[model samples]
Target: MNSDRAAANDVDVDLGRLFGSLRRHWLGMLLFALISAALVFLLAAAATPKFRAETRVLIEQRETVFTRPQGEEAAVPAALDAEAIASQAEIMASAPILTKVARDFDLASLDEFDTSEPSFVEQFLTIIGMKADPIAVTPEEAVLASFREKLEIYRVENARVIVISFSSEDPRLAAAIPNAIADAYLENQRDARQQSNADATEWLEPEIADLRERVREVEERVARYRAESDLLIGQNNTVLATQQLSEISSELSRARAARAAAEADAQAARRALNGGGSLDTLPDVLESGLVERLRERQVDLQAQIADLSTTLLGNHPRIRALQSQLSDLDAQIGSEIRKIITGLETRAETARQREEDLTAEVNRLKAESARADEEQVELRALEREAAAQRELLESYLTRYREASARRDRDLLPVDARIFSRAIVPQEAYFPKVLPLTIAAFVAALLVGAIVLLLRELFSGRAMRPAYAHGETEAPSAASAKTGTAKPAAASPELPPAPRPLDMEPAAQVPTTPAGLTALDIEKAADRLVANGVTRALFISPEGDEAAAAAVLVAREIADTGLRVLLLDLTSTGAASRPMLETSSYAGITNILAAEAQFADIIHADLYSDCHVIPIGTADPARALSGIDRLPLIMNSLTTAYEIVLVECGVTDAAGIERLADDNTQIFVSLIDPEDEAIEETAEALKEEGFGSPVLVSPVGHEPETVPPGRTVA
Candidate 1:
């Protein structure tokens, strides 16, 4: 408990001593700070102030009504993004726009922008070869360059609005430049649109005339084809030949039915005559009436013969006459039947002849219909082609009319409009004297603080009282404070090796005990180089005091032109407080978390070529998360720097395990040679493959002042 309290008191005393040093030199620090701030104020007052003016233009997707056909909407382009906005900015800042503005304003003659007349100072410097003479260029080019340099263009967030800014020594010129640029931009847009419309008209006129001639030609060709093919359309749009074929087919069918009926009648008549049946059944035989009469006469003759034969003898004259009449009647009936057969044959022959004539006509009409149908197919194809051409020609005429309207009216809508015009600024936008002066004061105060602190540190009187008093303590008293303060075993005597890499001799040690003095730090750097120890850890048995030793040693090594980095692993400002102080915690933990880049977090230290990475308020748990990456980080640092000195403070097994490698050098600070705590630490490091540790005496005492009873490693 007393040890913990004592450690806390030591921390308070360390902080108090630092503040006390600043307080003791307050007047000198204040004087230096005032002088620096005053110098900054004088320089700032001499600079010329520049006023800025801006104009806002809105860019949109739009087209004139005359350019588009009726019922057709204007095409909207794709949505604008960062690249499109930047493209617009480039256009506004282009040489053409700047040249136009310069020519109109006669900016070539202005003293502020004229490059032909170099300043007296520049001319003198050029003569001495300290500066180069201005390049010879046309006045137009010189003015354009000056105009572009002062011009600024940016887009409004989430909108298609462009803001053009111009800066100049004269407020009126600043205002005039942006407004002139905007007007020129609008003019360019108008001219571009007009040119496009004129081009459309130029191309469309010839095309429309060609289409009109083509329409007329196609119509005439269609009429000529119809006439030549003889494709006269009838009902249902059929050809006349096809209609004739249809009529002939119907008449032929009727004629065939009539012929069949006649043939059937003729066949019945012939059958009656050949079979010797009664002719009365045949229509032709009945119509004649001769057979009926013959039959009636025969019946009369038979009755007379029968009556006569009853009274008269055989071979009588009356009987003979009656018999002859009967025979004659039969002959007459046969004759009549023959005549009827002849008439039926004639009728059948007439029907067959009629059927043959109709069939021939139908066959001829069918051939004509086939020819007409084949021609009609070609005729329809031509008609379709003409129809399509007519449609296309009509469309072209419509578009041509719209283009003509646009060209004649000479009206074209600009895509952008000046929504806000620039006004003359009342005050300059740069070299704000008040804020700069205040900033200069703050900067100077920090610098003065650093100067005062460095002066106090070098004077050797700002160290803690313990550094001088503790050296006089007996071995028993030192042993109580440091648990391992017992005497150590002596090693074999060896000659001191020459310093490595031609290191300069170290300066004499200062009489201070806060940690290693400037001279001791230089010696440590020399020893580290001699041993070829690129990676080293400096720790105190108590942990808090070793940070200053590490920082000093790294700084001294950096002074020798070796790149060195001091890593402060302790959360307390032990390693970095003396050289730099920052509130934001960004270091290895940030690198491990991928939250920040190394360049963003790494800060330059007070000494030359020395960089320090403070443990900044990183969460201990988060920092520990990167424990496994410590070796990789150290290795990377070694490649970047000649030496990386880590202030491990009172070393933990976790800290040592992560940072230790085969060639690592371990240096420990000991207030007394026999401090038990430091000896135990050395033994632990050796067990962890660090080999034997190098012992460094605390500040305020030389190595020769140690008692003979004590052993130094």
Candidate 2:
């Protein structure tokens, strides 16, 4: 912090010295300043001015807070600070605010949105190097979020009065935005309140009634399923299902009888065919009781055989005798069984009747179960359809009632009145003319003052004096009486210069070191070289690089026939650098600084003409900022050759003026074509003299005459 103060003090001293320089050479500074002021004023006039328009607004709190949904909070809110509210008003003009405006204005649809297709406005913005970006929105927010950025709302100092303003190319648009913003905000509030009411009605009664019907219908369906399936109130139906068991038992008895009869028939036939004494026929095969009796007898015989076998085997003496007796008994039993079957037809008939009855009973039970299932399905279908119709009727009735109730209570809940409508803008809110102009002027002035001050301090010169050097010294009394000039409006900045008595004057002084004198080709070249012109970038303002070109030609003579290089830098693709002479390490400034050898960058011509470099594609603004590379390039190039010719066809004051420094010898300049071309150029030369520079005229093409009518055209 102390260092800063000291630096500030040093700056003050430097400023003092600068003022002293200006005091001694006030004539030069004044002349330059006058010319500058005139040029600025003329530019201000000639320039397609941005006329501004503004609309003002006042935002008052609404009667009630707006809610988006029932039982929820307000969707729209108003801030308390009056000035901040004004800012909100200003936001009405921002992109987030104006996206709707843009949609209203068809801004996005403009050809500018398409890089290949440009509209008039889009093309204009492109030429001016400007673009618009999309705005961001916040969560749960439905309007312009960056309202403050666009809207300029301000409360008069410590007061409730708010000023809402905006800017646009069209004054009508600027005026409209503020009113639109306010209207939008109010409309938003009204919508929220209305939506809340509607939502409340929608959620409150109808939804619950519909849910009740849904639950009732779904519940009834479940209840009917249990009843139809005979699953009464959590009771199992498995006990009633047991009737199926008796039916299966009856069928089993019939099957057993049929199997027994087939075996008895087979035994009888075998006995009849094997024995010499044969039965007349296989008798009463249909009589199943006879077959069953044979099976029983066989069972008993097997049991008796088992008892005998337990005692002795047939192969054994005792067992053999028993086995012979059993064989004879078996042969006789087949014939006996056949005779029993013929005589016992009634038993066989009884057995057949029993089997038939059991079969009939089983079949009847199955048919009854099928009929019951069909009846149950029909009952369930009828019950389900009835429930659906009842529910539908209930829902329609409920909706009708609620809607009728809402109609009965119909009322406008929120009051929305237009506090103000969009009005024609009276002033531009952005690029604020008064404030911006002042700011710009201050900035330009500060830069000018700093530059002037620095030059004065380092060069040790006076600004403007009451007496000239050629004039005889004035008597002390007369000199005192001459008095200082009114101090030139006492600059808003810069400290006062100390009297000559305060500090020792420099040992020597320059004649007109402050600015340019008469201009010529060589003089301009020298100025450019002094300004550190190594690799020149020529941009012709009036589509001609004549003056800068002449300077280049002069530099060529100094090159002594070495392979010199020139590079034309312009959008027109016109190669003007061939007119210059220069020894170069590299034609491209960047390559030269990076120590690129001349042979690499310099292309020798077949005609032995000086090598000319062509301008590569680059954004002009970005390329110009690399100015520090110039010195390094100059140092490298000048050593390889006699001279480095630089021709810069600068037209803008910012460009030429930016080149002003102690290193340069002079500033060669050209004039615009006009009726008073010579006079204007001469006057401009006088102003340049303040900078201690050289101004150049046309090269081989001297001043041309044009009739008065043609001049302005």
Candidate 3:
């Protein structure tokens, strides 16, 4: 096993054989690599060095004052995103931009751009059918082609920056071309914008003029219609028809009130004159001077007559005179009352006449107002049309002024702007000389290495294992019957096996020519149980098939009510096979990384009593690097299960040695009967104190039935 440990450590590096191969072929391999590198370096130095220069442009959506509403800042389109910037880059590389750049630089006249005559070498190549002759083209086309070939326009990812790059043999030309392209693109955008505005102005001018005429015509029609209908406007912007109607109604009401008052006064005067009450109570009678004077005279006469009657006889002249005066005064007073009553009647009659006149005027106005109302409706409709036309004309005029002003002032807005100018390049962008040379050298060395390996393989000089004592010899056939057969010398370590005391000496389970049989699996399980081996790790010299065999044995052991757990420690999960697909947990990685609990990683439902912990999320190398905990994990698993079977896939002696203990049984599964390395591998394991190795070969026949007395439940 010390030899096995030595072999395992040397597994990663084939230093001895590699150095021997180098010793034999160093001069030839080094010469080949150096020559190849030197040739590549020379070619790189000879190639034309192209200087690349780039100019950055920013695409901004510009805003103009004319486009914005009053009292607000101008509203531009949304900011340019990556896609918009890319569009600007395409415009910079477009045919128009290239043509303008070419014209400005007079590129068509340069030999680099327009080579009219073919060189002698090119002519010879064309005649020999190795190359085609150059096609004839106009100077413009030639210039365009040459410009495009050197130009590269692209946008930065996820940004609004556009880069215009140009590659040329001359550094100054490369720098100058990118700047020129950027300038041309900006100029092109300005020209296009100005042209659009100019076109807009051209279209707007006539439309504004026509709208103005329409407005005038409609307004004139409204005026003429108003005059013909005689409809007028009044204070408060109200139509005269409505105003007149309102005034007439008010006047008629006032006139009726006056007439009624006059009638009431007249009736009161008549009642007073007829002796219904005192004439003084009547305002008309009291206001008369003649009536008042007559009353006073009557009072004086009555007093004088009373005095004369007392002083003289009834026939006295003085008494008769006072009596006559009193009679005259009374007649005058009565006449005055009659006159007051007659004046009241005349006032009432005048009021009635005035009311009749006002009523007739009111009725005439009402008819006129109704007629005017119908006419005003038509007049308002015409006015609205005229007003709409005037507004439209004003709007067009404003737009026309703006467009024309922009065209005249040449203040066109351009969205693309150059922000970074290209400078003269100090170095060539092409060739990448040093890197190319190094890569060529490495590639040549790799080829040499491959050749060396092939030679070693064909020459049969590859390293062979050296075993202790007679361990290198092949084991006899009888050893296979005992299940302790030493496998052929395949590796320095013999495959570890279970002790013979674990199994009864039963008839041999025949070996399959290629694959495993059920009898072989059962015998392995029986031996494990007999030896009280709760923890066993299985390995194979020739990998995959043995992993499958381990799975069969684990499943068979589990069916017998022995709690069996199959730990798929294989890198490829070949041991767990179809069972590995049922779970997502990492088998050894989970345990090593401590990412999953034991219960989380274990899937007990996979096979009747068999628990399987699959390889989990951690990478294989990371898991394997943390294998110091493997012993502890195995110990814990042994306590939980009656049989913990580990399918150790293609592991070295050191890996197996780490897990092997006094009570642990290790089985080496083999498929090929005549593998020459088995004996050596077996001897190495034996020396490592892993006990005699068991060689379980698959026989290509149906699995033997369970032993008569020991059928699995």
Candidate 4:
């Protein structure tokens, strides 16, 4: 790719090839330039002009400004919780917060906003009957929301600043949109805080009610349980036990009196007459004795009755049988004296055992009663403490409720201030029209460059300037000889001018298919009736200017002393050296317009009686302007000279047609090896409306045989 580019640059300065190509395609470039420039100009004029405006909003580091004595002052936050406050600026751009700004400002309508050519909008408005053309082309609704959409905010890189920007057709509106959005953001923040407070209050109402219900339910259950279980002091069972025991003691005294009467007379005959009366007609239960014996007998009977259980109850058959036996025995004895003696034995032991057991049972009952009372008192105290705690909690909960209810109605955000102002910037804040246009144009140029380059490459054109010049020039070696005379040297000072023609006709020319020698040129001239060539244009293949001049000089000696025109038909004019003899001469380029006239421009040195037209030093513009008319211009010059010779130097095929008319014989010149390729160039000319070429000027080291087959007429 780089080599190809270098090759293209090489084509630029080669005057011959450049002129040729210019001569060929001059009309194309003109057409291209005119057509392109027109289309571009119209496209530019048809575009709508857009205007822009802007505003900047700096995100503050803190809500409150801080002052310091020396270093930079830090901003103080209104929030005691500084971290939450610091996050506000970042949150301003976050979706949750910015989304709120969008919603509050009602930004949904801007989705179809058109910022293209503004002229289209005027027609659209006129059709809708909304406005008097351009003056009133505004949306009927959702304007604020649309404006918020146009607004954009960004934190500046590595700076404590945020840039708020907006775009619109109207510059004032562009600025207004951002300011309105910033206000919306600030207002939204305040309302968001209030909303948060309302939500918290809403939740606490239900929680407070539930806590109260739970506390009341527990208190009610405690009260019901205590009342059902008889939770009072002296009315319980242990306290009533003593009165029942006293009633049982009165019944025992009555039983003792009955037994004493039965024992008064016993069976007195049965008694041994010493100590007591013995029962005779009525026997006593205590036969030998008194009341003590009668009571023991009655207790023995009671003890037997005690052994009888509930299966018999009081009316059991065995108990009744025993009762009958006891009655008969009482009858048979007919004395209470025996029963009283039996009662005496039982009375003392039973009373002592009953008293001991009653004492122990009373002591146990008193101890249990005391412990139970103590437990009840402690439980009551705990219950009271818990109730007091619950009451205190209820008081706090009530306070919380009041605070929430009041705060919900009147709450305000503590740190609400403008984090950034509604700034209207002096510079553009709207569509950014100029910068956008410039960017579009630059992008267009880059794309166009790529397109042009690819087009040139894909066309398969040769791109190398070196190829255009054929090859780099190496200084040619002079034809060396064995016995050649030392050529006449010019004097140190300038030599005297010769007559009109000073050529040696007798110089040996070589005639070979390879090229002409000096003697051969002389013979050729002799055949043409002594210097017979009239006006002639001599041409050669690429890189053959030196050989072309050698042939033209040979022609100058032939055919009536020809006058010559040797055109340096290259872009860079590299073939001028061979045309110079003693001092330099004026050239064909000098005859061009805005330069010297044709007669004055053509130089005639004293080299020969024959005159020569040297190749020109004209650039493309100068050459094409007047040299384009060169043939018509040259008609006047035929009167001054008899024969003409032109050194048609190495050149491209661009202007070959100029030398191809009936008045001119195009002599194709070549060197030995590359001369074979000259046929192809001839074919190209033929295709461009040129016929057969008069072959000449094939140079070699020495005179050689002219090959018949190789020579073409």
Candidate 5:
């Protein structure tokens, strides 16, 4: 077995072959690329270079404290969002603004903006009825159309800035147009604001006049209503009648309190007299100066009487005189106390009289206050109406004044301003000659290489036989039976095999001299199809060269219109390379390693209808970790395909057992029937209870060359 053959079979891309092909034609490819670049350079050089210039406008609240409306100066203006900026961009490109810019530049007279005649391509398309003819339009429309074509307006991403770009053959015009558009847009904004202000003032004029008249009328109505109802306002803004009633009620309360005091004093004096209590004990009597003096005299008289009685008998002159004086004093004091009692009664009567008068007056005032309250309700309603009118009139006046001031000063500001003006470009943005030429050259080279690859593929020189590496000459039937052979002379073509005398069917396996059955590629495929075998395992013990038998058998079965899949289980995809034309497909190993799925690994054979899974790029060691899944994967493949062919290269009976099932048919693929490995692998399969393995030979049926147009006999 040649290890190099495994490596050769495993390669997906032959870089050496690719480089060699390029090396053989590098001069021609380079020359073609250079010619393409030269053509692009010349075209770029001769082309009318158009210069592009852009003007940037910043959308923001441009109003300052002095210029802004009253009360707006302190407001934090919301920043323009992206949509607002985009709207501004649209406005900048509006027809009116563009028209102004065009007129300002007299763009209609400029040759750049003249589009009266159709282009050659357009005329050709129209003539062939591929495109409709353009409708007739005025020169202004034509010029506008041309102007619009060269204009590009967009808001800068994630920003509130708008960019206005224009292109022209004349760099100065290109620079001038965008600036003019920005200026026109600003002027338009100012004009719009001015118009709005003028409309506001015009509307407010009549409104203010009407409100003033209404305020005057309402005020007059309030005054008239107040006078008619006699609802005169007093101190503290209360109605006069209500105030008078309140004052009277307070005076009446005071009068009733004084009357009550007087009555109480008189009653207390009467009670003292009736109870025979001392007159001095009475508060009214004690408060009298006359009673106090009388009491003092009475006390002096009693002392005198007491002194006389101590010196003389009863009815003595001194005692008698003192007693008489004391009696006289008591009479006078009683008389005075009685007089005081009369005065208290008289005061009580006067107080009672006053209380009655106050109560009557209070009753009269209550009636007046109720009437006043009723009148005041209507009065208050009138005043409220007048007040509201006055307030509205004031607001209107203030707004009118502000609008007047603004109109006179022309203080309105546009929301957007030009932050950056367009400048005449030093270099043309179009016709970037050097870069375009280099790109053209690179593209041409790539295209040329692809064309060369296709040519090499169609000519069949890049393909080689799957078993070409380390191939040994197959021995004749007699030599194979004896297990000893000399190299046979090379023949132009393989001779036909002699038919068996019994004329055995193509589906029957022929018995070898050793009593072992062997089938050529076609006979093996026929036997599989006849038996309805869903799984066929090929053990390539003679190494990579013998694996060609598996590829040939799969192709033969596939040619019978059966859905066949060839699974390459070899260390290298020796068997898969001939069928798939590439070994770099993900397969059982990748599926086992969980690196790829069944869909990713399975690929259609390049030269036949058979599907194949290559040995894969995954590590074999990693794949073995999940080797237990091989039986499951085989079961899945068998369900999807009519026949599933597995090429197990140089694997033992234990390896075979892992992939084998009851329906599995084992074939020992052989390039040399006499090879010792074939016999050993067969014996091993038998020992493993896999039954006798059928020998499949590609000896006479192998293609001279593979992939492009090789076929089996």
Candidate 6:
């Protein structure tokens, strides 16, 4: 067991051994790296070097102030988006442009593009029917394929610039091809614009002539219709009759106003005469020259009477004569007013006659205007038709002029221009000898080191046994020398008891000893606690009842104030049933199957401080699917508890081998001390390099009563 613990402690990697392996094999590794770098250098030197050249074309509206159309000088041209730039790149690599470049360069005759004969490997494959004969193609097709392979066109990221690149064995040809492609693409755009202009000119010429004739005919028809209908436009673009009617209407309105004024004057004058009021009180009467003079005379006579009355008596001859004169003057003024009223009456009658004559003339003009309006509708229709034809003709003429100007001046410009011309490359683009050789050298050194390290590890020459503090190999040597094993001393809290295999050394034990020593549950538990065993794997060869020894021993250890866990790996719940509250509790199988976590599966033992995991409700087959995780589970349990007891029912040494580690103890539990299967199992475990199995019996330590809802099986 001490030897096994030393082997387990030595399992970690030793950096010193790895460094020693590298030191011893470094010369060979360096030589291998040198050879790899040399071969890479030679390959780089023998490979054909390719030179690449690039030309850039900027996609934009190329029209300058002078070349741009009228009224568009200040207009912003729509920018070419990413998709448009990509489309321009595709056009740069179009078949026509590529073919033109290929022909101009005579690419088909170049040795790089030669495809007349099949390769030696191809011929061999064809002869053996391993590969079918290749389909034949023309020289042009072969050249195009090779040219396309060498050419690369792509738009610069987030920009309206296209980069055209070509690779070739000849640096001059590489540079020239890209320049030629750019020139061809520009020329193609110009040709397309010119062709469009030419097409427009051809189509518009006849159409313009037809429109001019139609316009002339429509204008003549309008003129003839105007002459026949007598609907000539007069003032304000109105027909002649309509104009005359408007004039007559204006004159009639004035004449009626004059007549109303004259009648109003006559009526006002008559009302004054009848009401005994002075005629001068009326506006028209006051404005009249004769009436104004009469008013002044009356005012003078009143002043004179006022003065004479102040100085003369009424019976005086002189005063009477002056009064008589005043009477005569008043009578003269009255006669003049009567004459004015008669003139006003005559003027009003003359105004009435004039109003009647003007009204009759207006009625005659209205009839003429109505007839002319009817004719004007048809005339207006003819005029509209002529105007539409004339407008269309003008538009056609304008377009024709523009098209003719473009064709004559040859001012078409492409939207793209070559901004960068390709220059002959001075260096090859591929097979950088220095960098590649250095990389290969470094890579090979790493690979060689890795290979040597693997060899050292697999051969186990790098491993050296490790021992814990205050521990040594003296115990193993003493056991070998004495040929008898000493029993582990019991803990201070427990009584010393007989140990199972202390009577004979493990090496001298027979395959089927008839008088092998046996340990009751208490002594076995004390032995494990004393020896500080972290893991105890119980193999029950005598079936379910024998599994109880692992449970009892776990409980005994837990009672000593040491943490202990019993993991049931048995097919039945024999070992766990007495310690757990229920047989249906989740356990190791559930943990392996990932159905339950540790917190859910670990349960308190009913009668002891030990925790117990039952055989579990999960499917055993499913649990075995992840049985490779058993070691990890045991490691975790061992970390949390001082001792982890595993009851492996009816299993052999091989079955429990994965569960054991450096601090593990192996025990064969049985009801009978001399059971044949136990002896065979102990031999099997010994041959498998395990510590001699400790014999433990559960007969006297069985729990008197099982927990409720559980059976011991």
RMSD of each: 20.4, 26.2, 21.3, 23.6, 20.4, 17.1
In model 5, the Cα lDDT at residue 530 comes to 91
494: Cα error in model 4, Å: 26
User: TM-scores across all candidates?
Assistant: 0.48, 0.30, 0.53, 0.32, 0.58, 0.55
lDDT of each: 0.69, 0.45, 0.70, 0.46, 0.77, 0.76
Query: Compared with the true structure, what per-residue lDDT tens digits does model 3 show for residues 1-713?
Result: 22222321121223576457767788889999999999999999999888999999988756556654234445445546666677777888889888877888888776677656767986798789886446655667756866787888888877778888898888998999999988888888888888888889889988988898899899999989988998878878877877877887898898889889989999887876676677777887778888778778888888788887888987798888888888887778877787878888998899899899988988888899889989989999999999889888887888787777778877676877788999999999899999999999999998997887665543323333233355543232233224343435443243332211111333444443333222367688788867878788887777665566676677667655455788888777766544533335446797687666775566542222356776666766777777898888888877666678888877756778777777787777766656645555566777777766676644342333222121111
- Residue-level lDDT of model 6, residues 479-511, one tens digit each, is 222434222221122222221221121222223
Estimate the TM-score for candidate 5.
Answer: 0.58
Candidate 3, residue 229: lDDT: 94
lDDT of 1: 0.69
What's the count of clashing pairs in each model shown?
8, 45, 33, 90, 0, 0
How should the candidates be ordered by TM-score, best one leading? 5, 6, 3, 1, 4, 2
* lDDT for predicted candidate 6 compared with the true structure: 0.76
Off by over 4 Å in 2: 1-18, 47-99, 105-164, 207-418, 426-447, 459-713
Off by over 4 Å in 5: 1-24, 64-79, 125-135, 274-276, 284-339, 455-713
lDDT of 2 by residue, 517-626 (tens): 54444444455545544333232443443333433444333332222455443443334333212233234543524534444454332112244443433444555676
Residue 479's lDDT in candidate 6? 29
True-vs-predicted CA distance for residue 137, candidate 3, Å: 4.2
lDDT of 1 at 420: 95
Encode model 4's per-residue lDDT on 1-713: one tens digit a residue: 22322232232233343234444454655455445555555555564433344444444432222212123345553442434434655555555554554455445444335322345675687679864543343443234334446555665556545466666554555555566555665666667766775676676677668767766766775566555444433443322333333444454455444444333322232342235544332333334454445445656766676788445687888888767766755554444443444554355445545555555665665565565566566557656855865775576576565446546555343343444544444454333444545555555545554544443333212122233233332111110011121222311232322212222332322332333222233333343334334444545564544354334444334223232333444443334343344223456666664456664455332222223445554454776777666666555444344334455555445665554445544555544434555666566655666555445442332322212111000
Which digits, one per residue and each the tens of the lDDT, describe model 5 over residues 291-355?
A: 89988888888877777788888788778888888888888989999999999999989988988
User: Candidate 4, which segments miss by more than 4 Å at Cα?
Assistant: 1-150, 156-163, 167-171, 222-409, 414-416, 429-713
Q: Kindly list the per-residue Cα lDDT of model 1 for residues 359-413, writing each as its tens digit.
A: 9998898888899989988888888988988888888778777767766786566
1 versus 3: better TM-score goes to:
3
